[model samples]
Target: MEFFSKLLFLHEVASSHGKGLDELLIYVHLLMASLFVGWLAFFVIAVFKHRRSVNPKADYVGARSHFSTYAEIGVAAIEGLLLLGFAVPLWAKSVDKFPEEKDATVIQIMGQQFAWNAHYAGPDGKWGKQDVKFASSTNPFGLDSGDAGAKDDITCLREKFLIPVGKEVICKISSMDVIHCFKLPRMRVTQDAIPGMSIPVHFKPTKVGDYTITCAQLCGNLHSTMRGEFKVVEQAEFDKWFAEKAKAGGGGGFE
Candidate 1:
C-alpha cells in the first residue's frame, strides 16, 4: 500500500502537510480536466449542428436556451467554493499557525553567492552574535568568537542540513548577498530569502530520508549550482550528529 502511494506521488512525501498539498493539487487538476472536456464537447456539437447546409442561414439570436449562461455561472460558483474552502484555509494553516520556538527545532539558513550556510544553536539553545565585518570565506556566518553563546554554535556548509523526523523545524532564512528563494519541493515549502531580513519557514518532517533543497530564484551565474542536501533522521542519530559537529568546532567549509 505504501509502495503504491509512493508511486502515485512520484516524489517522497516527508512533510506532515504533504498529503494535504497533494490532494489540493489533484483536485485542481481534475477540475481543469473536467472543464476542458465539457467545453470541447460543446464546441464539437455546435460545429456539427450549425453547419452551413444544416442551418442554411446564421441566427443572430443564437441558441435561445440559457444553458450556456447557467454553465458559466456554475463554473464560477465552483471556483469561488474552491478558493474559499481549500485555498484560504491552507494558507492560514501554513502562515498563521507557526510553531513555538521552544517547542521546535529552530535553525538559521543564510544564503550567499553560491552556497547555503546552516546555523544551529547548539545544546545551549542560543544563537551567537554575527556581524558583516567578521564575515569571511571560512567564517561565512561571522560568529563573534568572544560571545559565550557562540562557543557551541554549529555552522554546516556544503549544504548538509540535518533534522530529526516528526519534529517541527522552524528555519530562519536570510540572504547575505542577493535575493534567493529557498525551496523544498516534496515538502511543498517555498519562501523568499531576502537580504538583511530573516523570514521564518516551518514544517514537520513525517519521514526519515534524504531530500534536496534548491534555490527557485535566479540569483546569479551559479544559481543552478546552489543546491543542498536535507537529511531527516531519528532523534538519537540527529543528536549524535549535532554533538560530533559541535565537538569538531562546528565550522564547515564550502565544496
Candidate 2:
C-alpha cells in the first residue's frame, strides 16, 4: 500500500516536472518499457517454442542467425544515440546556466536534522557577515555581530518556503549536519546540501500555487519529517506576507 501511494505521489510530481526535463524522461521511460516488453515477450516465446515437448530435440546447430546479430547491433546503436543525443545534452543544458541577476531573488537554505532554516539577505542583497565560531542554537548562521550590513537581515526556521510566482529565485544551500537533498518538483530543481559548503541553484515557477518540497536524502530516522512546501504567490501577496512575517517578530517565531 505504501509503495502504491508513493507511486501515485511520484506520478503527481512527475506530472508537474513534465514542464521541464520530465517530458524527455518520460520518453526515455517509454522507450525502455517498450524494449523491455519486447524482450520479455521474445524470451517467453523462445522458451515455449524451444521446449523439449515442442521441439523434442536440442540443436546447437543453426542457433546463430544473421537477424540476431543485426538486432544486437541495432539495439546498441539506438542506445548510443539516446545517450549522446538526449541524455548528455539535457544534463549539460541543465547545469550550464544560472539565472540572470537582474530582478532575481536570492534565498539561503540551511539544512538541519528534520527541518530547514531560511534566510533572506534583506534589502542589502548580501549575506552580510558570518562567523562560524559564534553559531549556536540562537545564532544558527553564526552571523558576525560586528557586520553592519548583516544587521537587518531576516531569518526563519520552518517547513515552508514562500516566493512570488514568475520571478527567478536562486537558492544557496548548505547543511549544518549531514548531507540532505533539497527538492522542488514543480520547479524541476534538486540539489544536495553538503555540510559547510554552499550550492547555488535556481528556478522559475510558471504556476502560481503551492508545491511540495521534500528531502530526497535518507538523512536519518527523522528524514520523513523533513517535508515542506513552497508557496508561489503573486508579487503583491508575497510582499504582504513577508512584511507581516517580519513585523510579527521574524518568520522563525511567527511559524
Candidate 3:
C-alpha cells in the first residue's frame, strides 16, 4: 500500500483512519484501471471485427449481445459497493463517531480570506465567550476581554498550534468571511469552513513532527499562500508549551 500510495503521489499518512482512506483510494483506482483496459480492448476488437475491408456494408443492427449489459451492471455494482461499504463508513467515523471530549484535544479554527486561525480553550477546557460585535482585525475570534474563559484562551493567527502525538484532535472549523477548506494533508483530513456554521473534523496524529495546514479552496487572490502549521509533539512538551502560553496570557501569535 505504501508503494501504491507513493505511485499515486499521496502524502505520508499520519492519522489513524488514513490507512482506510488509502485503501479505498487504491480500490477505486484499480476499478478505474480495469474499466480503462476493458474499454480499450473492446474498442480494438470492435474495430477489427467491423473494418471496411471485412464488411463493405454497415450492419443496421450492430452486434447485439447481453455481454455489454452485464458488464455495465457489474461496474455499477462495484461502484455502489465501494460507496456503501467503505466510503460511507469512513465518513461516518470522521464526522459522527467522535471520541470523548475529555480525552481529545478540541480546538476551534476560523478561516479568513487568506489565513487560518486557531483558538484553544487553555487549561480550563472551556471556550471563551465570543461575539460578532467584538470581532476585529486584531481579534479574529471575537474573544470577550471580560469573560474569565476568554482571559486564558489561546489564539494563534496564521501561526502554528501544538498538539500531543497519538491523541485524537477535534477541530471545529468555521469561516470568518469567505468559504474555505481546512486541509491537513498528512493527516488526511479535510473539512470546509463555511460562514455561520462550525463543522467538526477529527484526526489522530500518530507521528511527531511539523505538519502544514492549508486552505484547500480558492478563497481569494492569496489563497495559494494561505498556509498555517501545527506540531505534533510529545505529551510532556505540549504540556510545557501549553502552560507557558497560558502564563503569558495566551500570547497573541499573529503572523
Ranking by TM-score: 3, 1, 2
Best-matching candidate per TM-score: 3
Model 1, span 216-253: residue lDDT tens: 89999999999878899999999999999888875444
User: Considering only N, C-alpha and C atoms within 3 Å, which residue pairs clash in candidate 2?
Assistant: none
Put down candidate 3 lDDT per residue, 1-255, tens digits, no spaces: 878898899998988999999999999999999999999999999999989999999899976889999999999999999999999998897657999888999999999988888899988878888888878767888888878877778898878889999999989999889999999999999888998898888889999999999999889999999998999999999999988888787725422
The local lDDT score (0 to 100) that residue 83 gets in candidate 2 is 82
Q: How many backbone clashes does every candidate have?
A: 0, 0, 0
> What overall lDDT goes with each candidate model?
0.83, 0.72, 0.88
Q: Which scores better on TM-score, 1 or 2?
A: 1
Predicted candidate 2 versus true structure: per-residue lDDT over 1-255, tens digit per residue = 335335345434322223446645655666688789989998998988888887877786856768777878888887787788877886666655676765777888887887777777765566657767866655666666667666656677665667887787888898888999998765678899898998998777667877877798999999998976778888999888777665554423221
What order do candidates take by lDDT, descending?
Answer: 3, 1, 2
Q: Following a full C-alpha superposition, what root-mean-square deviation does model 2 have from the true structure? A: 4.3
- The residue ranges of model 3 lying beyond 4 angstroms of the native Cα positions read 251-255
Model 1: CA > 4 A from native: 1-10, 251-255
- Candidate 1: pairs in clash: none
